[model samples]
Target: MLTHTKFDSEAIANHITNWLHDYATNAKVKGFVVGISGGIDSALTSTLCARTGLPTLCLEMPIHQADSHVSRAKEHVKNLQARFSNVSSEEVDLTSTFAHFKEQVPQAGTQHLTDLTLANTRSRLRMVTLYYFAGIHNALVAGTGNKVEDFGVGFYTKYGDGGVDVSPIADLTKTEVRILARHLNVPDSILVAKPTDGLFGDDRSDEDQIGATYEELEWAMQQNDSGKVAADFTGREKEVFEIYKRLNTINQHKMQPIPVCKIPLNLT
Candidate 1:
């Protein structure tokens, strides 16, 4: 059962940090590199990385970022740098870079696909930037995805935010992330701020796109995991369950390994 393990925030935090340090050490990397998107997931991920006392480099790659996102990212980076000497930050404004790429790509697709592809492009560009720094500094690209986003709804962009050398928080639920963020003393601004992917320039929220809140999504995920079906749920629960299932089904490609067609020995 999901509840088999009781929620001990401190122990969980320590465990994640220990795992991160061990992975980096075993890999012989100097430190970790993370894209700070001014969301709770990234905030918590970067904080956990800092606790390891490893050289953590936080990248604020804003491609037409909202002012609020920019402020919070800068705020978190400053606080982290002040708290940890090993923490450092560099801002790579990718607005021009994204525009340049758009100039070269075709735009004959539907408006919806065009918009989504561009947003995914933003994420992929940031991924490239993260690895660029990782290569130069010999650091791992730490992913900032939580369990719900990573597995439940598959809300993240594949080969974009989903791309990472190490995922420190992908196992933690969104609610658990908030609890641990409080425990970590993440700034009140970030703690209370609405969760947005910040991929679009506007301050739209993840819920705006998902049609359900994280709390509801988490509940739906649990019910689905326990073999609960549409017959078991009513009203909003049913709606959320359906939404969860739809996304999970469509995004199964992202959650699973790429399909490989193996040639038989006869063909060989």
Candidate 2:
């Protein structure tokens, strides 16, 4: 038996669309900048940005982004551009740039970049690309993170995908995001596609990296935060819940504001 959560997708979509508009207008930004990764979160966020009726730059910064992923991203952008005049897209492949950096940058003694470090660098490179367009267009970068990655498990690279000018879906859970995506008419393929950061340079689903399904993770999050692990939970459920808790604890720093040094009053 699966747990069912109910929400009004239309209402949520409307609220988020308005929120993006107001946030950008108040900041005097000209438009929204989004990195479309061919994932549901980015697909939904990009759609909402288009709904704002402001210029939107949907950038596909592929640092070895998979072929299927690139194709899906292009399809989504094409669909959006056809339906909305404000939406535009570009594909900026960074594979060569990434290779150049790895080859040219001097490595410290016994300090070569690890695979995870290189993956994170890929994300940071994408962030930089988004900001490059944003700076030129006077736009804000719209993040694709959902509540689970943004707050619960904090499963995002710092200053990478985590670095954004505004997060329109940060408050919505992964489950709710899918609901909203349906309402927004995100392409069926993207809506049902397995979630991934596309940072591995290979095909690796987010669940494979996280060690648990989003549904299980979401349940664990709600149960743990509620202070009541369900008495009827099986051994597997308990194990999954514990995994979620461990990840949430380990990655909590990603969810917090950057630490700032405060001077003593007298010293100041």
Candidate 3:
């Protein structure tokens, strides 16, 4: 078992909250906008935004969202609303919009829309909704991705979940986010819930899609980044490390800024 570097969750939470407040103030934005997806990351992000006393709009843009996940999201919003007057929530169901898009496409049959494309579409739709709200309210869209997903494997959609003005937990690993969530007194339902993007429509977990557990992925990422795999790594551990490295390489573009062509001028 790999050991994580320990830190105080309360202190980290305070640091994040203060950073958000200062960022919003400096940017001259009114408040923050976050898409609530009934996942731990979103819950923690929204909680941190609420702690800043900013007008945090937690939008639940569910496009054929699962009943259980929707319930979890609403419960999270209700708890936030009760605790902080600045926090508010609204559910904008996008099933019809998605269905219409799928319907109108000539070559895009319902079956032809691959799971990957559909999932990316759902994420981009939510991003559009978040920005729509942000533009109207002069707010920045807060991202809910953590280190493992955001940087390690790049398990998010570019210009979709990746489209955000601020990323609060990008430096923290998935495990660290869970610890911070507990410190913030997040609801037990959310804390104990299985991690998912809620994009597939069918109930599939992050582990199922990623082919490795968060702990395994985190350990592998650390090993890969350090250029030293543990000698004690067994058969399963070795396999996971291979997967981790391959994913990191394949998704490197998502972790980097858009490439630009620089023009060299002979001024001399």
The residue pairs found clashing in candidate 2 are: none
Q: Write the per-residue lDDT of candidate 2 for residues 1-268, one digit (tens) a residue.
A: 2344557778878898999999999999999999999999999999999999999999999887788798889889998999999988888989999999889766644543467788888899988998999999999999999988888888899999999999999988888888888888889989888999899877799999889888888888888877865454779887888788888889978877778999999997
Better of 2 and 3 by TM-score: 3
* Model 1, position 67: C-alpha lDDT score: 93
The list of candidate 3 runs beyond 4 A from truth reads 106-113, 229-233, 266-268
Off by over 4 Å in 2: 1-6, 105-113, 229-234, 266-268
Per-prediction TM-score: 0.97, 0.93, 0.94
Per-residue lDDT of candidate 1, residues 1-268 (tens digit)? 1342478989999999999999999999999999998889999999999999999999999998999998998999999999999999999999999999999989856998888889888999999999999999999999999999999999999999998999999998888999899899888889999999988789989999999999889888999998998888789888989999999899999999999999999988
Give the C-alpha miss distance for residue 191 in model 2, angstroms: 1.6
**Total colliding residue pairs, candidate 2:** 0
The predicted structure with the larger lDDT, 1 or 3, is 1
Q: Estimate the lDDT of model 2.
A: 0.87
- Angstrom error of the Cα, residue 3, model 2: value is 5.4
Cα deviation at 86, candidate 2, in Å, is 0.8
